[model samples]
Target chain A: MAKQAPGVRIDGLTVVYKTPAGELPAVRDVTLTLEPGTITGIVGESGSGKSTMALSLLNAVQPPGRIAAGSVEIDGLGDVVGLRGEELRKARGKHIGYVFQAAQNSLNPLKTVGKQLLDLGRSHGVDDLRGLVREAKELLGRMGLDGARVLDSHQHELSGGMRQRVGIMLALVLNAHLVVLDEPTTALDMITQANILKIVREVHAERGLTTLVITHDIGVVAEVADRLAVMYGGRLVEQGPTRHVLGAPRHPYTRGLIRAIPRLVGDIAEAQALPGRPPTLATVPKEGCVFRERCPLRMDVCDTVDPEAHADGARAVACHAVTVKEHA
Target chain B: MVVIARRLAGHLARGVVMILVVATISFFIVRSIPGDPIAAHTQKLIEQGMAPEAAEQATRVLYGFQATGSLWEQYGDYVAGLLTFDLGQSVTHAGAPVTEVLGEAAKWTVLPVLAGTLLSFLVGIILGVYAAVKRSGKLGDVLAVSGSLLHGVPQYVLGLLLSAIFATLIPILPGDGPVDILYEPGFNAGYIGSLAEHAVLPVATYTLAAYGGWVLAMKSSVVTVLGDDFILAAELRGMKRSIVFRYIARNAILPLFTILALSLGLLLGGAVFIERIFNYPGLGLLLIESITMRDYALMGGAFLLITVSIIVANILADLFYSVIDPRVRSGEEVSA
Candidate 1:
């Protein structure tokens, strides 16, 4: 434990939801590392366990839910699996910071923004509330609102962008080392989304905060992520440095994702969409490649063997065809 | 301020129209009943008469019997009398003014209604918030189930049960009448405490009976609101559980506000049966009295007062709508 690296690390993390149909694994043996002072982008569509992964950090998943098997270890904090009562709360509040996707949510409408900020700041022992207010004012001012107005303002008074900025402020104010941002810009307009992402980048750099940004947009990953993890069917298909994974992709799923992105500068007609929708977790293929139904180069062996992570340079992919082709 | 004023004015206009229609309908409906007040009064005068002409003249003046006018003329005069706030003297009560009787009874009737409605609103909200926060667990499920169970039971049954237990068995509370505290009151705490003591059973009966409805409303609202994305967002902010509960409860509970306002308006109307069962001397009880005694003037005044009180309460609610809610402004802005 002492020798472990600083930041969030999950080894073989899995989550299963017990439904009327049966047990459905939402996250399947997903293992990755989010280093301190760096931003990691996780790209997946809805129901990709991107959210399940995020909630796993706080152990805040709803009932009929189970982590099943895995270890989620934060750098300074130990395993989050068994902690309960005040111990769990202290760890979640002090160590982990979470940012929800929507702006209209996350702040109390009944409370003033100043009070929300103050509550977080005071709880975490940032005794200098005046200084904190000054800092909050400065942050909101950068996002284009009168600093004084933001203090007295309720959430409804602000625009979507402003509300999201306040959300960012609420998460970052305590300077919690790890901030989990779940689709932070999805609900915003293009202009507002760009502004928010810009602010996120600026804040990350200025404070050296470690961020795990969950997004479905490959274009967003191309912009802000240092490394990328692509999840399909509740399992991570590929993860590596952003450039290598995007440019010299190995996994068939990863390859499909890049090819699917609409090309603005080149022939858009040449772009391809992923062959089929992501597989249902309830009835995932038992003894074969998860992507076999969609994979263009699937062999008979693909249906018989479960693929393991095969490394080619810094990139790791989970497909038998890719591994055999590269090895040959 | 302008919005509130405009809203109140609109409600007041509606209230005035409702009052006129209700008053007119009630007047005709009571009048259309079997016996005429004139004939009834004259019959008694005739029974005790010294001479037939004297009896006829006596009944005529008592009833404003105008042999020279048509029914329309009489109705016009009645409208005029109503406009001048003259409800006319009670035919049965012999010289007691209609307005004076109602004014005295209105306070007694409104007290129980006010107590019941407020208790229901407050208790329902608290319980609803509790049920929502605890949703998905045994506690939340239990609260929700129990609230539904109690809500499904008739209000009268609950009221009677309470009356039976406290009024009949223990005899700790005076179940039927308002205490004349000023006369028989002891100063252990003062007349106020004794008055409160006397009012306890009625308030409790009303409170217990009404609480279930509020609980169900609040619970459902909270559950639905909790499902919204905002609640998850707030939780992620690392806001304390208490703050989260408060914010979620207040915002999610907005629909309940209008329901509460409507309930407050219907309060006087609802109390009639309850007051009758308890023999409480409220407007509802008096209403029953006036109707049974065939006293048209008193009954008309009572009905008008209850209708006006309801309208006024709703108007007050409309005025207060924006005060408790910030989203109201944004909603108004969008609609405007």
Candidate 2:
């Protein structure tokens, strides 16, 4: 047995949001491990609780929501579930880094980009002032930016891609163990998106920093992630090595998602469009598989009983029809 | 700075046009009311042994109004006088130039409004930021509700209540007026002390009423900014909550600054009633006297000044908007 590398460890992570309508479980019973210096992609459509799962790492989930029953243990910091106040704040800034979507919106429009980066470094008690600035210069320089000019300019002065590159620089400044990027490149154009993904890979390799990248685009997962976890309706339906999962997606939902992507050179008829919208948290089925209503292979047993993940080699998938009818 | 200057120039040009329009409209509005200035004056003078008809004719000739053409001519002459800053004599005040009379009144009226506005702006911003940052708690809710509830109560009502408590019940402050008879304006310590003592009640009254508006504006703006995506971004960047607040509240507060300047302009006009209520002998009281005595020239001068004050205030607001927001490079850009 090989032990997972030191990074973020979550066991039975259940996040329930206390809305006005009642308790809504956003991320229900999710468990995954992110290895050190490895990129893990959590691919899910919107409302799949991927963002909620990311926010939980920083203890920054908006109010009326909480980690209901789970243990989220980072490598250095033991358990983050019950920590609060100054202790929680200290742990967050010193240990975890975050990069949000909409990089232009992320930087304060009022302050110069240089001032923001300097402040971030100083907050972490980086005392060598010139060293910090030099590193910031080098970082921006790496992202196809003239560090000196971009640093002095305000957020509004820069184009969208430049603003996102600066956002990545802010996240990576402190050399924190883990950086949580929730759709960091989503707002960028395709060319800029490729550039940002390249920068992410370069920085991860150089610093050996653990990276958890959340995106809906499987292309990003395929490019950067060593492993993939497919989240649907706030649950991790399948997870394994990227090559294994994408090559042979054992879960019906995963297979549908891969098929849905339009191939660049394939025939138009080969494109498989998944029908119906994703289910809301409230209307999620109580019986049978969560994807049963939309799944093509729905049997008599699937109507009466919910399916659990069955181990197939190193990959895990939650389809009873695949597990019982084929593997069993 | 270049942006602010360009916008200010455009506003100044508009202000000049506004002054002319307001003065012309004010002249006609005052004249259209049927009344003989001569007769009104003669009626008062007759009780003191002046021959009524001769005095009426003398007054009519002085006013240059023997026919309808003369009325138009009078209006034209008055407009010319205003352009040259030659506001004629105040008939009711007896030999004071309209400008001199207004100058004295303006000092009294402007003092309280200035004091109130400064306090309102400063206090309102601080309270607003605190309330927003601490929202979902008791203090924020209390601030929000109290500001709204107090804002609904008119300034005069608030003034009267404050006067009753501090001026009447406590007897620690003067109830009204800029200064008591004993107190005089000068460099002398005794006079200065007395003057300050007299100013306290009126200043407090004005501030209490105006504070609610500023507080409400800022509190709502700050709260709105707190919910902005930028604040969360700042948080994720590991910025201290206080630093995040500066970014959020300062940007959110830009529109309120314009509101502050515009309100200052209206405050000059609204102070008429407030001045009369306090018997402060300000522009409002002078205006009332001029209208009652048919002192057309003095009334025209006062109206022109008030209108000009409004235009200038708006121009200042425009300048401030440009200074605070980089996106608004020019008024032309804004319009485009």
Runs in model 2 deviating more than 4 A are A1-6, A266-270, A285-288, A299-307, B44-51, B54-84, B163-173, B188-190, B329-336
Give DockQ for candidates 1 onward, in order. 0.44, 0.48
Task: List per-prediction Cα lDDT, in the order shown.
Answer: 0.77, 0.79
TM-score of each: 0.87, 0.90
Residue clash pairs of candidate 2? none
Q: Which 10-residue window in model 2 chain A sums to the lowest lDDT? A: A1-10
Backbone-clash count (model 2): 0
Worst 10 residues of 1 chain A by lDDT: A1-10
lDDT digits (tens) for residues A1-328 of candidate 2: 3222348888788888887778888888888888777899999998888999999888788877888988888887778887787667666655777887854388776778888776666666678878878888898898889999998887777887888787777777666668888897886889988888998888888777888999999999999999999988888899999999999888888999999998899697898889887878786666677788888887888887867776666677777888887755
TM-scores for chain A, candidates in order? 0.91, 0.93
For residue B297, what is the lDDT in candidate 1?
A: 77
Could you give me the TM-score of model 2 versus the true structure?
0.90
* Stretch of 10 with least lDDT, candidate 2 chain B: B327-336
